[model samples]
Target chain A: MPERRPKIIGFCCEKHGLDCVTLAARSERQYDASVRLIRVPCTGRVDGMHILQALEDGADVVFVLGCLEKNCYYDTGSIEGRKRVEYVKGMLAETGIEPERVEMFNASSSMAWKFHDIVSSMKDVAERLGPIRPKGGGSE
Target chain B: MIVAERKPLDEIAKMIAPYEKVAVIGCRSCVAICLAGGEKEVNMLVSAMRLKNRKDGRKQSLDGFVLERQCEKEWVKEVEEKILDSDIVLSMSCSLGTQTIGDMYPHKIIVPGLNTAIFGVPEEQGVWSEKCLGCGDCIIDTTGGICPIARCAKSMLNGPCGGSSDGHCEVNTDIECAWYAIHERLKLQNRLELMEYVRPPKNWSTSHSGGRRIIVKEDAKLTPHQKRGREVLE
Candidate 1:
């Protein structure tokens, strides 16, 4: 048997969230290739269904990256995103899954370091949790 | 609109655990507006149940559907095939919607995914406050267009209870005393004199206390001849 690499999914707001990630890449910073990012118009558009579906599809860890709550591009988009993340976490807890498997992070366009930190932290979580076992048997 | 809250995920999970095929149905009317049961909620719940099943090493098939108004027979009829195909139905609507499906198919297993809370209006973006009790009688005309029966702690029709303090209900500080609000509204409308006229004892027979009440609209109902004709057509 070989070591298994964790799979991670991140739902990022196109506004500040994507900007931060893009800037990090431009700065020659490298994050794990296993982390896949899905861009949306705003964090508010990321519903709880998306997060749960990610986990259900076998992603070890999932997260939403949005603009800071106080300075969201759409005023309350980040707040809404945080609320949905919290709701998903509650559902996960109820389902006997680790609530920490899903998380929400805030970022600004200029904060490349924050993007790296978010990815690193989420990657760490995925590594710790390993892959979520599929319905029948083997992990994805 | 009727307001409701989703039942805990564990409870819902346990409800359909014995069934291999389950259908999660949601209503797009009041439950949708309240963010309790709707298309999105049905999908979320299905996904959550799937994940939970996967975690527990259980294999169950779950499908999600939404009805325009689950309380209506026509809307429920549209999904009759889907309801019949499933071993159990998890209704994500108010009790009325749940009962509609149960009534339509007495032999099928129907369970509620939400706890019907109140007849309320959205106070703000995410807040819903109970505003009516469906008492079957309208008395707001004498109470400044505010129903003290629903808002007041004691449902006192005459005036504020002694426990009311500083415009808040004694039952719960968060509740605004309905009588105080009525008084303010009456004063604002320059109808303070209306308060002096004491209300007589309310007739409780018109309310739910009277036991299952029914209103027959004779004009709208089909006559015996029409019923026979419709039966022939069917």
Candidate 2:
């Protein structure tokens, strides 16, 4: 039996979110969770280029979770993130990959439930999408 | 400030794929501030390029070095010999810096590792808005320090077209109406009266429309190569 593990990468807005993300994946062993979550000061820091970089670096699906729109202390960071996500999704569509591979969602303080739901759904989506053709066979 | 973006690592790797001795250079000016061709990006790119090439079974020679300003020949004088020694160069600067190297060393095979964008300003963090189109004109004075050429969706010089509504451009709901912003700025300064002054149709000679630009001054004459060649050989 081939152990099919969906590779999902997430951009978390905080260390707290990162901790929860890792914990949830560890606790729920149902999916072969090869999730690589990168924590940034804010989701706004994730540029369209960076999202594409993650996909090119080998992520079946990419998600960016940011502070609610207008809620970021950095002023319009969530808006920037939203804009970048849309731009990256458009680029994916142009590049033959479905734009749905990349997603943008809003989050704040104690939305661990929302975070869990997103990751769970992403794992489900990636399982359906299957493994992408890894770049140059350069395994991460 | 100038606009620039980093080149794709795989494409860049492919450029230097044939050469074993590669000299990668970074410009510390425009591209640096843009975080595209800066020192930090140079280091990261070299590492990534190396890994990518190695995976393809080709051993590449790459050494990363950043000049204080790659657009000028003086700042890069110290590395002239090293640059010449390399089989090829990977210019990680904007078009100007990359071309400057090509101008200085005509024989060296210089490959551009970045895409030059435009004359723009940073809007906030990680966002850049183009302000100058490098058009052959300067009517900003009448626009109350706002650029109608670069910002206006239609690049209208005189006034807002009928399309603008609520200070927002019809081109996109999200984008601010540049002329509306200009009008508000002029109104605040009590200089709204300047709008009536019709400047002449701009002279194309003063801008990119004319030809290659040249700035000659008495002080910075005869580059190091010229001066050294004249003084040391006798």
Candidate 3:
């Protein structure tokens, strides 16, 4: 069998999340191409369904990137996002999926180094977990 | 309103495993307000199920629909065709909605997605405490508007039982004793005399102990035409 690249999906809060990523790009900081970033109005807007949908779409891991807790552009938006991520983690665990497969991170727009580290950390975890085995009796 | 929580995902997945096509239905009334069964919840459940199918290599299709109110016959009628079209239905609404769907379509398999918790009000953003038992006999007036039937651990009509101390129920120190709350409330209102009145045993027949119950209002009875959907409002 050959090795397969783990698919990683990131739900980024536009206010700070996307800005930080742009900063990382300008600084010429390299990150894995396997990571896909989706920008939303605020991290709070990233519903639990969106996270689950991303996973169902074959992404090995999903992460929610948001503004610092007390500094969210939408007030408690990032905090709400954190709660949502935590909720999905519990659900995944109940379904026999690794809770670590989903994660939430906080950072400001100027923190390009932090954003890079976040992506690297998520990618590493996804690689360690490997592909999810289909439930029931079947071979994928 | 009814408050409920979604059942574990694995349990729901197993229930719908036998079906090839499933409809995930949600209610916009009580369950929706509680964030249990609603349009958002329906979508998430469907998405999670699809992911499970993908990982398991199972060939199943899941769809979502949110009714205005699943317990009402009229609102439920709107999705009659869509539900009938699916191989099975996974209801995200409370048990009432699940049963209502089951009653309307006796032949189809109805899967309950939520565990109906209680009839209560939201004390905070995500916390809900049971406040009503639907005992069919409401005596809150004499209890200073604090219901002993629902709030009391033992449902003691005249309480603050021997187990109550420091205004907390012995069953759980974290819970405030309903009778204690009643006493304070009544005292503040200068109606402490109401508490001295000896109370008689409650009529259990008004509760679930009496078996399935129904309310009939002669004036609210539907006409034959209305029963046939002749007067269904859009």
Clashes per model (N, Cα, C within 3 A): 0, 0, 2
After superposition, candidate 2 runs with Cα above 4 Å error: A1-140, B135-137, B218-234
- Residue B141 Cα positional deviation in candidate 3, in Å, after optimal superposition: 0.8
Task: Report model 1's TM-score to 2 decimal places.
Answer: 0.96
lDDT string, candidate 3, B1-234, tens digits: 899999988889899999998989999999999999999988887876776666667798999999998988889999888898999999999999999999999999999999999999999999999999999999999999999999999999887799999999999999999999999999999999989976799999999999999999988998787777855653
Please state the error at residue A5 of candidate 1 in Å.
2.5
lDDT (Cα, tens digit) per residue for candidate 2, span A50-92: 7766765667788988777766656677788888789667545
Among these predictions, the greatest lDDT belongs to 1
| Runs off by more than 4 Å, candidate 3 | A1-6, A129-140, B223-234
Could you tell me the lDDT of residue B6 within candidate 2? 70
After TM-score superposition, the amount by which residue B168's alpha carbon in candidate 2 deviates from its true location, in angstroms, is 2.7
Rank by lDDT, highest first: 1, 3, 2
The order of the candidates by DockQ, greatest first, is 1, 3, 2
Model 2 residue B10 distance off true place after TM-score fit, in angstroms: 3.6
What's model 1's lDDT at B97? Answer: 92
Q: Which is the winner by lDDT between candidate 1 and candidate 2?
A: 1
Residue B51 accuracy (lDDT) in model 3: 64
Off by over 4 Å in 1: A134-140
- Ranked candidates (TM-score, high to low): 1, 3, 2
